[model samples]
Target chain A: MPAVHAEGLFKVFGRRPADAVRRLQDGASVADVRESGATPAVIDAGFSVEPGEIFVVMGLSGSGKSTLLRMLNGLLETTAGTVRVGDAELTALDAPALRRLRQERMSMVFQHFALFPHRSVLDNAAYALEVRGVDRATRRAKAREALALVGLDQWADQKPGQLSGGMKQRVGLARALAADTDLLLMDEAFSALDPLIRREMQDQLLELQASLGKTIVFITHDLNEAMRLGDRIAIMRDGRIVQIGTPDQILETPADDYVRQFLADVDRGRVFTAGHVMVPAPALVAPTAAPAQVLQTMRDTRAGSVLVGDGDGRVVGVATEDVVRTAVAAGASSLAGLPLLPAVDVRATTPLNDLLAAAAQDEVPVTVVDDDGRLAGVVPRGAVLAALGGVPRPAAQPPVALAEAEAVPPADETALITSGGIRG
Target chain B: MAESSDDSGLLPRIPVGEWVDTAFDWVTENFEPVLDAISTASGAGVDGLTDALLLPPAILLAALLALLGGVLRSVRFGIASLVGLLLLISMEMWEPAMQTLALILVATVIAVAIGIPVGIAAAKSSRVSAVVRPVLDFMQTMPALVYLIPAVTFFGIGVVSGVVMTIIFALPPGVRLTELGIRQVDGELVEAGHAFGSPPGKILRGVQLPLALPTIMAGVNQVIMLALSMAVIAGFVGAGGLGGLVVTSLSRLDLGLGVEAGLAVVILAIYLDRLTSAFGQQRRGFPSFLSRGGTVTTTAAASSRSVDAPVTGATDQNARPEPAR
Candidate 1:
């Protein structure tokens, strides 16, 4: 079951919420509904978070991503629909029950860190447990453990006012970790930090997630952060979700003009991967094949080169037509002992920018291999250039080179080939 | 036609005086137990504190005052308190001054105990604030002399009446400052408390109250000052203290005695004001004892310099005029 399921959720901020919701259901614009005496902050939003997945809600300010997140935690009441966390329906729970659910199953980290100024760092971290009526010794021990997890144990006894901003945010993270809830809600938790610190925090959070695997609902206005951290990102605009997809899917096939414009400035080479842009190998020749057969296969396919695979279908090397011609002129019967040209082999998961140099240096397409070293597909130079240029490739003729690929000035090829790839 | 013209021309008189008299009469008749209970409690408190102050030897009381002043304010204030109290003793008014001090202390305690909860209620609800605002305005603006009549009618002329009148006159600042303090607590901090799942009461006690304490202490200082001023006025209702001494000296046309008693009150007021203000400042970690040169002598010198700087020009001008003459 999904860890959190929000269906048809609505949050209208002003008076006459029911009327606003009804008008929204009847397809009235948010501005029109607001004109009739209510402001719709979140309109008919619905999404389900799979267990142990990081689901990100991405939008500009006032697009209701935070409002939608607050509704999932029952911090804000939903006007029109239901939210289920695990087996319990949040909207149906009483105040105490809802508080108990929050205390037991969910924790949130805020953008401002929200450390109580009067409390010591240890006390701030232990607050959620204290609210749950846990004993002092146990809660303090747990809080110390959590502080240690965030690498802040030495500063436990100091007041929050004494800590730097990054340390304070770590204390906030420690507070949530000490609660040890199944679901974590982080609302722009790193947005207030400096850029260098924010990057460090992102790496720390990814490491924590790898080990903890807690289902997290992260809210961010930064699309780059969403792309880097989210397993699935839901893009919101004007109080409605416009698209939800993996980063590669969203980059390759945007849902609408809004998404298209949204992604226009994105560095597609870094986001797109070898698997996303690779074409299936034209033909595969076994090592035992005759040189004539290999040459004929290369001609039948595209006349550039053919991949030579072992009997188990793992790629051994590439056989170029020149090498085949050389072998046939020397009266070689079988191509098994004939030399093959060097080919650049990369994992299918390797990002496209990482293959730019190898693709530029070799005329043969870069080989994409799976875990077992079997040939999965080939990323042609034209496909890489097309993907980087943000041009859509035709479905049937995946290996066809774009005319723009040949138009590239020779002076810029080396610069383009060695451009910095995306940072993990 | 003439009668109608007269009625139209004459402005109708409001029976505000009669209404007020009747309201007081009704309260006096029905709430006698409440008044009696307050009188009895205040009488015991004043009598106990008065005995505690007066029964101590003159030297002991002076030393105690000096110690308190040194601890709360500066050592200069402490030495000044020692000299002031010795002067009061020499004038044979120490007992009356201590009685006055007792009256002010009891009144301040009662005022704060009642004021803070009302202020918290007002901070929590706009309706309560609306109701409280005008009532506080009325309490503050009414003549201090006007309260004596009601006090005399309710608890009759004594220390009880004096303390009651002082509480009434001093209560408004306590309420207003407490409400303002709570209202001014950072809204984001309050929201943080709420998001942590704390109930309203716990949030008020743990978060709001601690943050609001410095402002509330300011209110307490105001209450003490106002109560001291009113206690002197309560002398008209036969509440005997330094004010009664001044009143007697005035009746006898003895300017020397009146001047001495009045000077004693001024000394007490300055001492209390400095002490309370110092207490408020300490809440924010001021006057750090850990800092270098934070000894008693340095603090005393600093404080005296601040107080004496303004008088230097006047003294210099006076000296020049005398030399010219």
Candidate 2:
């Protein structure tokens, strides 16, 4: 079963909420409900979070993303429909039962770090466990471990008032982790930090999620953040979800003009990976293939280069037409013996932004390799440039390239072939 | 009809004073048992506290108070307490000073005990807040002396009557500030408590109470100041203290005694004010013995030595980003 399944959820605020919900369910619009004096904060919202998935809800302020999250956790009761978390129907649970569910099964991290100023950092991290009635020694040990995960074990004795905004937010994350729940709901958990700190936090959360594998429903107004973190993102607008898709899918085929307009601000290079733009390997030849046969295959495909894979299907290197012709003239038996061009190979998950220099310098496309160095696909220089230019910049904001290029580390020569082309 | 319309012959006189007298008489006649029990209990409480305070040698008490003030507040306030207490002793007002202190202390403790829960309730519910607002207004706006009439009638002329009047006059700020404090706590923090599955009671105890304590302490300070002023007024009802001494000195035209008694009241006010306000300003992480309450204080230190400089340093450490790895 999916970890969380919410269906037909509606939360109306102001007077006569039930009646407003009835009107909403009867096909009245959010504006219509507002005109009638009851504000429809969330309207017929529904989705499921798969186990170990980062399901992000993305929207601007007042889009009811937060309201929908609260409904899933049973903090705000649904006026219209149901929410099932695991096997339990969360909408059916009473207040005490919901509290028990929140205690044992789900935990939340807040936007402003919501840490108690009076509590020590360790105590703040241990708060959720304390509320669960865990024994002090066990809870403290667990809290220390969680703080260590966030690299804050040394500051455990200090109060949160002494910590900076980033450190305070680490305490918030630690509190959620210490709960040891399978499900975590984070409402803009990184939005309060400075941009550099925000990116660092995003990297940390991704690294943490890799090992912990908790099901998380993260909420954010920043589409770029949603794109980076979400395995599948749901776009919300005016109390309704307008689209649900993976990052690449949303970029390639936005559901409506609203999503397209929102995507205008996204730096596509950081979000789109090699896997997103790579085409099938151009021409493949076994490493033992005769140089004559390699030349014949490259001519048949009208390709400039061909990938040479060994018995394991892992690309050894690329052989260009000139290299193959030279090898043929020199009477080499197999393409493996020929001097091959240095085609930079990268894992499919490498961000397109990281491949810019490699793609710009090499004549051959960047090879996409799987975990065992097996051939996957190839991202060409043109594909990388096309992907980066897919979205236009918003007129008022500066272009993202200048700042982002500065953020890239000095190129690593082994992984990136920045100077050479086809070795003549 | 024309005569009635004129200012001098407006209408039949309303018997507001008589009606109030009748109301007081009815309460006195009907609720005598409950009133008597309260009077006896509070009277004994005041007597026990006054005797205990007086039992300590004045010099010993002064030193102990000075040490407490020094450790909990700052060294400067501590020295001030020592000097002020000695001056009160030199003027021969030590006994009456202790008497006034006991009265104010008892009244403040009682006022705070009852006021906080009411304030929490008011903060939680608009109905309770609406009902409390005007009653607090009336309690605060009424003259401090007017409370003495019912106080004397209810408990009879003594320290009990004085304590009762002081409680009434001092109660409003305690309630108001407590409510304001709880109400002013960040809404996101409360939402966070609920999101973490804390019940309402736990949220109130663990989250609301600690955050609201500074404001509540401010309220307690207000209560103490108002009680000191009102306790002196209660002396007109024959409740013996420095107020009685001042009244006697006034009657006899003895300027020296009046000045001494007035000076003693000032010393008591300043001491209590500083001590309670210090509780509101006390920072966390101090030795448990030095800390007054569990809450964290945001105010800087009053002394020139700058004991709180480390706290500002801690904040600055995280304010800037770490250098690139």
Best by lDDT: 2
Chain B TM, every candidate:
0.84, 0.86
**Deviation in Å, model 2, residue A101 alpha carbon:** 0.8
lDDT of 2 at B297: 30
lDDT of 2 by residue, B1-325 (tens): 6765795575678899999999999999999999999888888887889899999899999999988877777667788899999999999999988888888888888988888888889999999999998998787667666888889888888988998888877887788878888998898889888888999999999999898887777777677877788778867877678888988998999999999998888888778776776777564434323443223332333331142233223323222111111
Per-residue lDDT of model 1, residues B26-85, tens digit only = 999999999899889999999999998888897898889877877666666678778888
Task: Give the proportion of true interface contacts each model preserves, from 0 to 1.
Answer: 0.24, 0.76
Off by over 4 Å in 2: A286-301, A328-336, A391-424, B1-19, B283-325
For every candidate, how close is chain A to the native chain A in TM-score? 0.83, 0.87
Instruction: List each candidate's DockQ score.
Output: 0.36, 0.63
Query: Scored by CA lDDT, what does every candidate get?
Result: 0.79, 0.81
Please write out the lDDT profile of model 2 over residues A1-424, one tens digit for every residue. 9999999988889989999998878888777888888998888888889999999999999999999999989888888899999999999998999999999999999999999988999999999999999999999999999999999999999999999999999999999999999999999999999999999999999999999999999999999999999999999999999999998789877999999999999989888888766654433566777888767755654556766666565667777789999989999998777777665888778899888888776457687777777666666565576679884323432222212322322212211221111221
CAPRI-style class, candidate 2: medium
Query: Candidate 1: where are CA atoms >4 Å away?
Result: A252-255, A265-270, A281-367, A371-375, A397-424, B1-11, B72-93, B245-259, B281-287, B290-325
TM-score for each of the candidates: 0.82, 0.87
